[model samples]
Target: MTTALLLAVVVLGAALQRVSGMGFALVVGPLLVLLVGPVDGVLLVNLCGLLFSLLMLATTRGAVDWRRLALLAPSALVGIVPGALLLAAVSAPVLEIVVGVLVMAGMSAALLARHAPALDGRFAPVVAGAVSGAMSVTAGTSGPALAVYAVASRWDPRSFAATAQPYFVMVAAGSVTVKLLLTDARLPALGAWGYGGIAAGCVVGLFVGRALAGRLSPGRTRAVLVVVAFAGGLATAVRGVASL
Candidate 1:
């Protein structure tokens, strides 16, 4: 039952990511933390997120904004180190609560401020990248920060979506490295079949998302993603409090 649930989560996350270009972690991270412990589940997310981004980049490579990505990557590292330390310092229940709250706050912030002032300044990417990195490490969600940034900067949707893949790759890699160095967090102990299921899920999700690309409305997809993420985050927080 657990394995089936995990696979379902992975598949849904990947499909959303394909449709929205940045929802894999937001949709899946909190739920994974609920199913598994915070450490292992988040670690699994980083690992899988890394691969998911790589797979996405294969098709979206043409639209990447290299200069924006260059600015984002360095600051992301700045945030990652501290985020790793914080993750290492917290207890599992505390981490779960933190992840849940972050998810909720991030989503709320992204959803609420639809018309934020334009942020076309030179330093915007740096700030966005740093926040995204911290969020990625602590909660495995980078989309909300980038989403806000995209809106503020009036980034082109195609470029933003394409650029997000590589950015996610960098964030996931840095997050995993720092966690390994600064904490005892290790990859989840999901066995061979489990790993295989994850791979299959990713593939299936990408395919489904691709098929639905023209048929599914982006606004509708985003609405469903937001609802699921919010509910999952609340449940995770409740579970954390109960455990404590």
Candidate 2:
């Protein structure tokens, strides 16, 4: 992609992430794949996602639930390696298709199970985080798993979105680390000019997204999250099919 086009997508994606709390990858991953090919694009997506969540946490520190982060983050860290290994073991296109189908199915279930029993007991968060981490590495998204947790527990949207910032920060960072260690892929250099463009885009996104976020009600936030899930699922499915 042209430098301007790349910046435009990043800015828009960063804004969506800021507004909805979990859409940077969903909004930008496919486009980046088109721009820079799949592997490099995914690396950029992971890096940009980490940046987005860092800024989010800086702005909304008080809302972070450390207790939750404690459970989710470590589990995610552990889970990423296995997820990467799983990807290595499986056929890429087939695995991606399966992952995409499962994501869509999971989203459907979450929608129906909104009124279903909330998860409890000791290992619930562990399971959620582990699954989230696995998905983050394999599919370049862990948002759907976290989204179901937020909805099933009936968390207030703002609080849920706020808490998710830290989770994304950790998961994105961890995924990048694991991808670096386990895969042959190394992140492509952006150079000084590219970095500057990214920085400017982030600055613009932060301002625009915060302004838009103020307008969302709890219901609307949930609505937006649901839309993000569908988009993520569809994108994954398309990538799978296209690869085939």
Candidate 3:
């Protein structure tokens, strides 16, 4: 029964990631921790995330915007080092609360803003990428930061997904590296099975999400963004409080 529940969580997490480019960790991490343990849950989610990133890259290959990614990617890389260091030192519970508050606040701001300002100028992506990278180490959900920048840049869905792809891939790699270096933390056998389930879920979800992305009107897209932002924020808050 526990094994079945874990598998179901992975599937659901993958579906969430397929639609939003993220959320697997938010959905699966906490539950996995509850069922297994924190360390095991983190390992499982990270592995699944790595596979998911590859799948997303393949699915959105042709549509990627190399230009924006080129601008933002370096900053993300730079930020990850510090983030990794911080993660090594800080307590998980504290990090969770901080991240949760930020998520909620960011969502609130985005929703309340009257106009989406232009953030595509010279330094915005760099700043956003750096922040996203740092946040990834702690929260594993830097998609909100990237999304805000993308929205400001006026990137269409394909370009947004494309530009963000490598960031996720790199962040996942950085996270796994950090985890391996810190301790003798080994991936669980059960997690290996979970990865397959998540991958299958992501594949199906991606197609559906892509189709929905095409049909969404601008207003609807904005609405979705607002909702996701709030969800991310709420997840962060819950994680944070739980840590406390």
Candidate 4:
């Protein structure tokens, strides 16, 4: 029953991510933590999120801005080392709460802010990459930081989604690698069924999201998705607080 529920959650979350390029963790990360315990949940979210990005990138390769990749990917990789070390020191519950709060706060701000500052300066991408990298490693979700930068840059939906695919894939890879190398931390032994479920959920969700994405208005859909993500983040934070 638990596994089935988790699969359902992943399907929904990954579907949102498919359309938005940023909602997978905000939608599913917190609940996964509650369902499987914090460490395993974060590991699961990162891996599954990575898988989703790979699948999305497969079809959207042409749309990605190659120039941005140069600035964003390396900084994110550099950020992972410190984030993993921080994860080692922090308690699971505290991390969960922090992830939840950050998700909600960032999404809310993105929605409420009518003015998006232009990313014209040379240093803008660098700062965005660093913050995104830290967030990705520590919280298993880098979308908010990327979202903020994407908004500021006035990127269209297609450009944002395509550009984000590589960013997310790299950050997740670096984060997992750091966690494995620098400390005793490891992905919980979820066995074959767990891995299978994650793969299946992401594949189905991605295809579905692709099919539906063309039908929605990007601006409106983005706002709606943020609202949903906010709700999911709230739930995760509440669970974390309740557990404490």
Candidate 5:
């Protein structure tokens, strides 16, 4: 049952990610934490997310904005260290609470700041990248920070979507690497068949996303994403408190 649920969550997440260039973690992170334990769940999210992003990047590469990727990728590299350390130090229940709180807070901020004025200058991407990197490593959800940046910078939606893939790739890779090196955390032993299912889920999701691209509006998709994320976060937080 847990494996089945995990596959469903991954499929849903990857589809949403294809549609928005983000939201895989928003949809999958908290729920996975519930299905598995917090640490293994987050590690699985990073690993799966890396694979999904790599696949998406191949299709979106033509539309990518190199300038944005250049600004965001390296700073993200610098920010994962502390995140890995935090993961190492925290207890599972505490980490669950942290994950829940961060997800809720990040999503709220992104929703509220959608109409904010354009944020120009060099520091914007730098800050966003660093925050995103830390969040990605800590919670396996980097979209909110980058979402805020995309809106503030008045980025072209298509380009933002495309550019985000490579950025996600970098952040997820760095996150997994640092976590392995600096922390003792390991992914739950999802065997070859389990991993194969995850990969297939991503592929199916991308196909579904393409099919739905014409019929579904971005607004509706985002609305659903926010709702799912908020619910998952609330549930995880409540579970953490009860456990504590």
Candidate 6:
């Protein structure tokens, strides 16, 4: 039953992610934590996230902005090690609340600043990359940060998705590596089997999202993003209140 639930989360989360280029962790993390323990849930999510990102990397290869990504890669890589260390030290509840508040605030600010000047400065990518790396470790939600940076840069959807894919893949890889180094939790045999199911779901979800993307007018997409962002914030707040 637990495995089935996890699989469902993966399917639904991946569908959301395919449409938005983010939101998988936002949707999946809480439910997975409820089904499994927090630590195991995070580990499993990281593993699946890596796989999903890799798949995106392949599918969107021709569309990525190589120059922009190159500017960010160095700082992102440098930031991940320290980020991993921090994640090892922080409590999950604290991390969740912090992440939740930040996502909500960032998305709200972005929405309000729809007419604001684009962040075209050369240093923007470095700053965004560093923040993304740290957040990925601390909260398991690098999507919001990446979204902010991508939107500011004015990337078309395909370019945005492709450029953001590697960062997520790297973050997941960092999380898994750190977890393996710090803990003795054996990768369950069942988890391996579960991956197949999640992978299948992701493929189907991606196709569905791509097909639906054209039908969603810009206003509709923005509306959905607003709701998802609010939901993410609410989820985090609930966890925080429960912890308190």
Which candidate achieves the best TM-score against the true structure? 2
What TM value does model 4 have? 0.86
Q: What lDDT is obtained when candidate 3 is compared to the true structure?
A: 0.68
How does residue 128 of candidate 6 score in lDDT?
78
RMSD (Cα, Å) for all candidates, in order, is 3.1, 1.6, 2.6, 2.6, 3.0, 2.6
lDDT of 1 by residue, 1-244 (tens): 8778878988888887776677787566766666567777788888888888888888779989999999988898788887777767766567658767766786677667657666686698898888778877776666666766775565765577678899899889999888888877787777897788788888888887667655756466555546655765665567668778
Give the distance in Å from residue 73's predicted Cα in candidate 3 to where it truly belongs: 2.0
Could you tell me which 10 consecutive residues in candidate 1 have the lowest summed lDDT?
216-225
Task: Give candidate 2's whole-model lDDT.
Answer: 0.79
Arrange candidates by TM-score, descending. 2, 4, 6, 3, 5, 1
**TM per prediction:** 0.82, 0.93, 0.84, 0.86, 0.83, 0.85
Candidate 2 residues 1-244, lDDT tens each? 5678778877888888777778888877887677677766777788888887888788877877778778888998888889889877876667667777877787787788877777655487787788889888887888877776666667676777788888988888898988888876577777886767777787788788889999988799888887887788778888888898
**Which 10 successive residues of model 4 have the least lDDT summed?**
223-232
Clashing pairs in 5: none
lDDT of each: 0.75, 0.79, 0.68, 0.75, 0.76, 0.69
Candidates 2 and 4: which is better by TM-score? 2
Comparison by TM-score, 4 against 6, better one: 4
Question: Looking at candidate 1, what is the lDDT of residue 58?
Answer: 89
Candidate 6 residues lying further than 4 Å off, grouped into runs, are: 182-193, 217-230
lDDT for each residue of candidate 4 in 1-244, tens digit (9 for 90 to 100): 7678768877888788777777888777877777677666777788888888999899888989888888888888887777777777876557658867876776667656647565566577777788778776666777776776666566676777788898899998887777678766567776788778878888888888888788889786666445655665676567668767
**Clashes by residue pair, model 3:** 96-240, 97-240, 100-236, 100-237, 104-233
Give the Å shift of residue 92 in candidate 5.
6.0
How well does model 6 score by local distance difference test?
0.69
Which window of 10 residues has the lowest lDDT sum in candidate 5? 220-229
Cα shift from native, residue 159, model 2 (Å): 1.3
